[model samples]
Target: MTAIPPSPATAAPLGDGLRFAFGTLTVLPVRVTRWDRGAARTGMLCAPVAGLVVGLAAAALGTALLLLGTGPLLAAVGSAAVPAALTRGLHLDGLADTADGLGSGKPAADALQIMKRSDIGPFGVVTLLFVLLAQVAVLAQAYDGGWARGALAALVSATAARTALTLASRTGVPAARPEGLGAAVAGTVPVRAALLVLAAVTAAAASAGAAFGTYDLIRYALAVLAAVAAAELLLRHCTRRFGGVTGDVFGALAETAATAALVVLATG
Candidate 1:
């Protein structure tokens, strides 16, 4: 059997984690440099950072549309489309597969096999619609009251997704075959870097909440935390059932967290 190559081992120990994570974002095939030392830095950071950038751009466009007299629905739809365009449907694809996998009622391996199929199933379609509807609902509500909060939510939610990746990588093992992107990132990211991303997201969330008197920062925080915890549990289950988390799981976690955040903030 061919062995999965480990991350690199040449770098200094202190910042190797960040370097490895950042490297994963770049266009380099640095998947397996070393294992014990936890050294490779291939292309993992790209997704979250890209999410943030795309989300921000989408929010701006949404806000601009609102200012130009577009209805809340159109603005919300446009904003949601930003990340979709940026990732070119990567997360959505994952989101769909994850929905199908988790909802299929098949064995874990069978569900995973279904996820690997190119065609989206009935469960996948429903999951995608639910996610999109949830996003649009929150966005429309936020825009009706205030676009600033809505935009900030978009930014922070995207960042939170990246942080979720870190949590998954640190806590869960990879699946049997180390062929996909999850294997490329597992155990390679630094906790500190992940914390930094979380901090940034927190700041963004707080700032957004502050704009509206109703922003119950603590409530939103707790909701996000809960979402993360739930995601971790799901990841752990996947690890036990399938040996590790996948890229689709990561994306599903992000979408779940973001949805939870919105719900909490809305209620708060």
Candidate 2:
């Protein structure tokens, strides 16, 4: 039977859009404001879109701050805070748990069990430090160069990371049962929708950078491409190791990929 599409009326509107977006990107774990079992799958599908919107808003804010004479370091730092606010620190928690889980070196199930715990572990601490250092270094470099380039890097890198979520979703099974948001979202993403998002995001980013300098446009494009490749490899490895994806893995991928992208730009 053809499944009836999940509706916003029955689900959380904001959450539903996120689930739809995530489904497009293939990352899962979309939670509605009020939990609704029926809307679980739909919400998972929407997450990527929400993430994209969130990323754009952050980039815009950071770019605006830079234009207003804020240093890149301050602007980058400020921009980063938006995602934490929008997602209520959900991805940051995911980053920590995924690090702990991966670092545990236990069986996948055991590692996931560790992730479920509320306390942060050694792996989480190290991973967070690493990611933060990478981000700061890259952002600092971009800021030193100019505001437009930094904005392009931020926007393109963010879009690419969100796109990677779809690949992650496709590559793994849900870690939990009762078919949580992740499972429901598996195989539900539309390829065309994802491509369109990618195209639009890339175009906008490239245009912005080009307005500043053609060289910057090319540089950001290369960086963004490298970031996407790195994310694909990381997710592929994670999928193979764990037999599926998790919320933490998704967050980790986004942060890692974006940082790597920035670092690449810095070095080049």
Candidate 3:
């Protein structure tokens, strides 16, 4: 089916935007007063802000563990678990569903249908296994460098991941279906808004690198650029394979971007 434009509405208030973002993106208890198209659009725009909160919390946990002389592996595991727990693993589920759909190599309809099934498939299983493992491994390596470095990486990666949502919602992007998140926010982001988000996230990443002293300016910028590149590629691939973006697609982009950012930081 062809994608439809969102209904006309005024820009969401900052209070409503925060409500929508925190309520939808995390399992945190927040009252969402508005559930309209405007709110959804604002939430997508503000997604990176929510990520900052999650990332900071996760980093704090890992840093605390490290300060207590916990092993890098344990610190890493704790750091990784914070976001997953706070977000109710919503993004991970998206990653799994997207992997399953893409791996099916069937028609778009069939693949989407496969993704909607509650049970995990072989593709989803394998993707989750490796992705989660990679997160732990890379995070552990970062922690080995120092608690501050590990915390900075986690913070930057989380912010970068959520920034992908804004890009995915840019104008001309289509919703895979007529209902749900894809329909609610797809094509809602304007070029100006997307650019602003990109700039903000880039600055945040650079600041993190400078604060940590582990990554030089060039390396940090490259890592952010690489993560953004990966997210864009995923968006294009999903559009081709699924005929448009879905809620799962948003999740997939966020997780993929986060992992890419973290991996780059760890390696650098």
Candidate 1 vs. truth: CA RMSD? 4.6
Report, for every candidate in turn, its global Cα lDDT versus the true structure.
0.63, 0.62, 0.84
Error of 2 at 54 (Å): 2.1
Task: For each of the candidates, give the backbone clash count.
Answer: 17, 23, 0
In the range 1-268, model 2's lDDT, one tens digit per residue, is: 1233233223346555555554333334543343442344344434445556766777788788888897888778766666666666666777898788878888877887898799999989888888877776676667667776666556666666665565444412343322344444444444554445556545665566677678767766666666667777766666666666666677777777677667777865
Higher TM-score: candidate 1 or 2? 1
Error of 3 at 91 (Å): 0.7
Pick by lDDT: 1 or 3, better one? 3
Q: How many clashes would you count in candidate 2?
A: 23
Best-to-worst ranking by TM-score:
3, 1, 2
